[model samples]
Target: MKHLASNLYYLRTRNGYTQEELANHLFLTHQTISNHETGKTEPDFSIIQKYADFYHISAEDLLLNDLSKKEKNSRIIFDSVIFDKRDKVFIIISGTKGTYSYKNIKKCEILNEKARYKGKEEPFTHQVVTGVDWLVQANILEQPFYVGLRLTMKDGTHLAIYTSKQPTRTQTDFHIRDVKEAEKIKELIDKIIMKYKNDESYKMDNVNSKNIFFDKDRQTFQILSGSKGIYPMKDVCKCQIVFEDAKYYGKTKPFSHRLLISSFESFFVTLRDTYVGLEIELKNKEKLYVYVSNIKQKHHSDAFKADVKVAETLKKYFKTIITGNKTMKDE
Candidate 1:
């Protein structure tokens, strides 16, 4: 802690604040600020932590490094914060949202909405794995400068990490202290997302080649069969996966088939003929329908039907994604 007193003096003076002002910000008496800067009194661990947090640098770095040197304190935010993981490229930037690898991640986007870190006032929030791909950058412009990035995992656990500390929830949005740095981070993340998201290796295989994929976390349905299309999960007012194996038209008969879907358990569905469609009703009252016409199954009579109960877990997962109201039975 040899450099602690000098560092404290430099930080306060560098910010152009009087001892009393710094004291007020830290909720301490002016004498404590003076004593610490003068090296008359040393702060304990808890007080040291407060100082490190206020300055937005790691406590260890503040303690060991000579921050008063121009190059020492002039750290590039990304260089100091980001570290590579494994043989893969550097993807996740550790912050309030915790470090996460891009591959395991479902999406990341800018969220301009200002709110308390769903956890604490500090910037560090959830997540700590690191990997790549897919980003949904949202620039919410309620005001001039309250921007944040909403990073979500595949499992639906999400968090919005803003650049600097914001006021408590009751007030309107305001500019965060390090907004410019935050924006650069956002752009950097977006670039990484674009690079890996389209790579053939990162995406999951299509659903039976129907060109449709369901994002369980986002609760949204996408159809990439022809052109790209997206629909929010809540917009899905109707859904059914029907099985159709046989159809008799006046003079012809269709054979029966078994459809097998691998999940937590393997099971088969036998249907003479079935139709599966997902319907969406948009805010503009427009209707969109996506039908699964790719499944073709025919099987012998000896094939056994799957246990319908096995679908319950998946059912609940999807239900949590869509289903707006409390409904008849609560999940």
Candidate 2:
């Protein structure tokens, strides 16, 4: 670790490898390499050996001696043993590593380049197409084809890697054509998300209004004081939020058809901007709407634009959650 950083940097430049090029050779991300070169972070012992192996040097020399000077006694070290036992998966975007765990993937989007062009029926009208749609449209105005992968990790790392010469909306490029491969990976990740979504103990808890949340593992949906039901995720057709009244559940009881709604006290009123309305539509065309909870807000104060962000996130979360569950049943 003493001369490791400087030595790596020196050897990479001596071998005419840019940080990214060296990173590719090492099967690591450019950021990780940059951190190592700049002494901001250290690599694992196994990773250090990879660097040594790449440059045909010993790890001891790589970490202790200054390679820029004459190395009269240095010898190469080679080991073929595999040590790590954990079952892991890795995707090389270009040459950088896309480290992911099934449980840690938040979103996997296959980004096929989008284009807008004049329609056949109306030259003055514009139509938009995405992904492989251009293969069918075959319009002259179609832009150069580009397809890429975008994934958001649970740790907040958003990675976008492209197989084409150009990226979708980011700069991570591989200059290789692997659009089909990207689509397959996205499908695999979607399954991972679905599998985790149904965990009985998995709950967003404070992330959204708890007045309505599903116990996915048990296939149960609950409400604060309105009504509760146990139905499979496949039965959920849709859901909506009502942000108009504070005591919306009291004013308009939801899902009272067969649910046992309990009489509960009302505290504060909810507003359109503040959010609290949760309406779930079942496959049978029945709807259930209610305010989040009487005392859902942590503080009683004037509503700000930022105050609504959490609710907005919850709305998106529910949409994807239900959509994922619905697709599983359909398949």
Candidate 3:
């Protein structure tokens, strides 16, 4: 409030906007802009919010905060907007035939959480918590300029956070108006990530001596069992983890899913799953199914399955990186 006039003039000039241009952008007359800058008048709270949003700063900071201090951080709250939790996030993937799609989260789940947090945290955060389960339970392992997360359900269903590079397209948006605040938020996030990592249940991943680890440098998913090759994640169409009576494969077994890579026409195994099946549509429009069961073929060839993790990772990487279909795809 103390620097309202000064801040307005400074920000206008700093952004290379004339008083007339700024007024036009704000749908106001130049005289009004001049009046505000000259301290003859003040903008209403709504107009103040618009100015803050245009400048990518917080309204609170724009009104009452001093920004000239030589502080250690300059992080600014860019934006924060309310989102309706009851609404469903729709995914539309079109093929030559039509489309394959599903809601990102079930409505019942959102309603339950919404009711649970009626007077508590933001309703939208509940969806984030459900998808990125670690957010509420873990400490930050790392924070980057841009981050993406994949949340896989028990039945191979999954969701991706910010699958597209565009921030406007993402589900959640929040900004801190100061660098020090950003650092503090990062510290808090790191603590949450660490909490999840420390959880005993977090250790149950399908990794072992025989498991093929995803190689970041090579951009491939490869585990050497009887094979000596790496597989790129992009080409995978689908994957599955099969199951049989008492014997389970790929960590817990029946809960797993299989993967099919479009470019990898030949059948191969990159990791150890109970049963691995690749479904490919031939150029002739014929469907081919290749099944691999464990290190040995004896158990049940048709029963190759994929776990939620493997299926989710492969499918997500395929859709986001390879297919380039985050929102909608036209065949």
TM-scores of the candidates in the order shown:
0.27, 0.31, 0.25
Q: On a 0 to 100 scale, what is the lDDT of residue 36 in model 1?
A: 92
Per-residue lDDT of model 3, residues 1-331, tens digit only: 8877777886675444678878888898999989988889999999999888766556887778654341113222212111111111122111011111222221112111222322244322343222354344222421122122233333555333221122111123421122233244344333323322332232325333244455433345553532334655434443333322223433442323433423343344323234443232322443333332344332213332233234344333333323322111211
- Per-residue lDDT of model 1, residues 1-331, tens digit only: 8888988987666444678877888999999999998889999999999998776556786677677674333322452133222212222232342334443456666444433333454322432111121121222222222345666666877645555354322123433335455567666556545534443232334233344666634446676532248866544443333233334211221112323333342234433333233334454566554433433223322221221221232233334333432220121
- Better structure of 2 and 3 per lDDT: 2
Off by over 4 Å in 1: 1-76, 79-97, 113-146, 166-177, 201-331
Off by over 4 Å in 3: 68-331
The best candidate by lDDT is 2
Residue 155 of model 2 has an lDDT of 93
Task: Rank the models by lDDT, top first.
Answer: 2, 1, 3
Question: Least accurate stretch of 10 residues (summed lDDT) in model 2?
Answer: 76-85
Worst 10 residues of 1 by lDDT: 128-137
Q: TM-score ranking from best to worst?
A: 2, 1, 3
Each prediction's RMSD over C-alphas, in Å, is 20.8, 18.6, 22.3
Give Cα-based local distance difference scores for all models: 0.47, 0.52, 0.39
